[model samples]
Target: MTRELDLVVVGSLNVDLTAAVRRHPQPGETVSATALSTSAGGKGANQAVAAARLGARTALVGRVGADAHGEDLLTALRADGVETAHTLRDESESTGTALISVASSGENSIIVSAAANARLSPDDIARARPLLASARVVSVVLEVPVETVCAAARAALESGARLALNLSPVVDLPAEVLAAADPLIVNEHEAREILQRNGSQLPDGEVAHAEALRAIGARSAVVTFGARGSAVAEPGRAERVPGVPTEAVDTTGAGDAFAAAVAWRLSRGDSLPEAARWATRVGARSVQHPGAQPSYPTLQQVLDEPGLPV
Candidate 1:
């Protein structure tokens, strides 16, 4: 029998082409970039790497194209100790790519061409059913088809695995899938957009936003507020956790690190708030470097950094 996985990530994998700019281009405007770099990325792949770096036995379930970029992504994941047994390759489409522009302020804007990621289907999830069943936590992201994410959630639920849904680039998810999310993670903007889409009243504060999300469907909710830390809400409780202070060099992929950390900690039986606290610290560490996967801190790096909690 296959050893149970600590975390299973069902999502997208992409090669990130990043450019450093003085500022983001205005609408329909062109700008010169100072430098350009290439790295492995994709929400699914990033989460798997982040969790593995943090000492979780993680696996990835997604698709890449039959190309060099796809091979590079697989290499990066394997280097980080993530199992890629379920990561497939499609010949019809090119590998997914993300065009990222990082401004001098460390904030970034990204445009993704999903390519083979778009080909991931419910069948992919079904093929990975055994891996999902053996995971303590299964994380799903929205970079792929929503139906595929829903299928992963259902499989996780049926297998009694905790579901951690990172609802970035938010979309309308079914109530059942939302409910399965032990903690549905989203940034402040995403949290508001979700409420707006559901035709619900906007909450006045971040903590309120988390509570509103829990009220909507998620078993719990987390509203990340960048450097301010995150707001966490669960049954009969809601609170904010402050971020660890760090000099951010690049903000890209920090959110993926946060989501991965939360799921990994949850698999270890940490309470939702405690997990979010640790996740916040991990996120802070990621910003101290450049790129997505390259910037993620290992467990030692995170623990070595000056922080209240280990």
Candidate 2:
């Protein structure tokens, strides 16, 4: 049976090993952790779950190891309402894992081991072309190989679906890929990298980041500035969309949530500004919880929150 999808995410999936510590340790120094946990995470998996919980018909395309972690990760994704038929199992490598340490201030440091995630190839994407063709929007992150991402993007484009790219871990994208994406999501640091690589001056303020993004060929851009909020820009207009007020517990997966919400809203035919507002609220909600996928809110939670100006 084939199900129509509102959004399809082509990327990585991993088990997250998290420890809450007093502070990040300096080089050659060790810090004691106050709490510890393990959960499912990965930019792609996080976003796919976020979208699915928010009532989007979401499908995930990636690879997982034939290990215990992989089994648990797939179960969690299914529980979150994400379609996992396209997720491949690799016996050659273990499931990917992320080692994360969160400080009391909500800041975090992370190291990722892309085991099975790195094994996702263009052929895998090609096999999922039918699902990609049925989606209203297709989202991709940089965690997967650039070639595979490009293949997915091209497939989405050919299918007349909107292509959304999260320029995470901040890498320079080829001009062709950038042109194919409808809206590119990035943070302040990523904006700086894009501007620097293009030999363009940095935007003076948060709003300027949008213009900088447009100058680089993005049809539209959203630059998130954490507590300060986010900026949304198209060719001629740009504005700061304020974030919802919330006490952050852990900042992990906040950006992925924001990106997912934006794509979901846009898939529903909302204006860019309206979608940015939804994304901002979703991001704020994610920070109030601890783990990545576990912290993400369902659509009802967002709709029921009185703080959001629906």
In order of appearance, the predictions have TM-scores of: 0.98, 0.97
Cα lDDT listed for each candidate:
0.93, 0.91
lDDT of each residue in 127-227, candidate 2, tens digit only:
99999998999999999888898899889888889999998877767788888767889989888988888889896988888878888788888899998
Q: Which candidate number has the best TM-score?
A: 1
- Residue-by-residue lDDT tens digits, candidate 1, 26-63: 99999999999999999999999999999999999999
Candidate 2: which stretches are off by over 4 Å? 1-3
Note each model's CA RMSD in angstroms.
1.2, 1.6
Query: Highest lDDT, which number?
Result: 1
Which residue pairs clash in candidate 1?
none
